[model samples]
Target: MADELVKAGILSAPEEIDKYYLHGSGHFIGLYTHDVGEDPDNLLQKDMMFTLEPGLYFPEEGIGIRIEDTLLVTEDGCEVLTADIPKTVVEIEAFMQS
Candidate 1:
């Protein structure tokens, strides 16, 4: 992710990547607030309920966006638990315009 940001000129260097994004891509959300799942290799497994969170913080540019999606891993794929809420840009704008 940092490499792509550098190539696109969104970030100066990989070392500064933490400055713009300050959140984990995902974390376990079962058993307690943060389960810390028993995955030693840090690999996501099946039946794991967690949050896939992505964030971008460019405070100097006045841009900050963070997305959170709670998911339940399954054999077929993952199910978004937050799907009940409208999160698309078009949906949000239309709702706001109403």
Candidate 2:
């Protein structure tokens, strides 16, 4: 995903990567924001809940963005519980105007 972001010109330098992920990528979202969970090395299983949060931060530009979604692991893939939220720039702008 970081590679894609860089390719799209959303990120300027590879050095910015560390600033974006100063904390871990994401964590379990049950009971608490950082719920108890096994190590990420464990295989994902059905019904497991987690937060998929990717961020980009540019302190020099005073810009920071983070998109987060709760996911439910399934047999084949995962389901985004926060699908209704507006993620794209157009969608977010439209939502704000409404």
Candidate 2: tens digits of C-alpha lDDT, residues 23-93:
66679867777897767789888999999887767777888878889999999899999999999999999
State the C-alpha lDDT per candidate: 0.83, 0.82
The most accurate candidate by TM-score is 2
TM-score of each: 0.68, 0.80
- Error of model 2, residue 11, in angstroms: 6.2
List where candidate 2 sits over 4 angstroms from the true fold.
5-16
Q: Which candidate tops lDDT?
A: 1
Candidate 1 lDDT trough over 10 residues, lowest sum: 37-46
**RMSD of model 1, in Å?**
3.0
Residues 2-98, model 1: lDDT tens digits: 8998999988888878998887787789788777877747766678898888888998999888778899988888999998766789988888898
Q: Which stretches of candidate 1 lie over 4 Å from their true place?
A: 1-9, 12-16, 40-43
